[model samples]
Target: MQHFICTGGCDGESSTPGVCQAEDCKKEGEALTPCNCEDGLHGEVVEKKDEDED
Candidate 1:
């Protein structure tokens, strides 16, 4: 499983972060394919590993 990230502003870090669909979003409606497309304030390659794997 995977999720998008915002390396600029969000840094993929938020209390409720995943994919920002807001107007301030770097890559609105962007999918996590061909990853690392720096969309404004975003970079979609941050992987959140599963706890099960740890």
Candidate 2:
């Protein structure tokens, strides 16, 4: 699967290509780029909680 991301390094991501929403990128009408990673795995950090920690 592929996803779209902001060309200007914004947080805009979607399943389909679309214009960026960042103020700076929006000003230049930046478009999203096709993500070339596995299911858009951009090194995101996930925090798992222990069932007994809470």
- In order, candidate lDDTs are 0.41, 0.58
Name model 2 segments beyond 4 Å from true: 26-28, 39-54
Which lDDT tens digits does candidate 1 get at residues 1-54? 233454323344333335545455455544323343444333345446345422
Candidate 1 segments whose C-alpha is farther than 4 A from its true place: 6-20, 33-54
lDDT of 2 by residue, 1-54 (tens): 677776444557778977777776532466666775674554432124335422
The TM-score that candidate 2 achieves is 0.52
Residue 6, candidate 2: alpha-carbon lDDT: 64
RMSD to the hidden true structure, all candidates: 12.4, 9.8
Worst 10 residues of 1 by lDDT: 7-16
Return the number of clashes found in candidate 2.
Answer: 0
**Best candidate according to lDDT:** 2
State the RMSD for candidate 2: 9.8
Pairs that collide in candidate 1 are none
Model 2 score (lDDT): 0.58
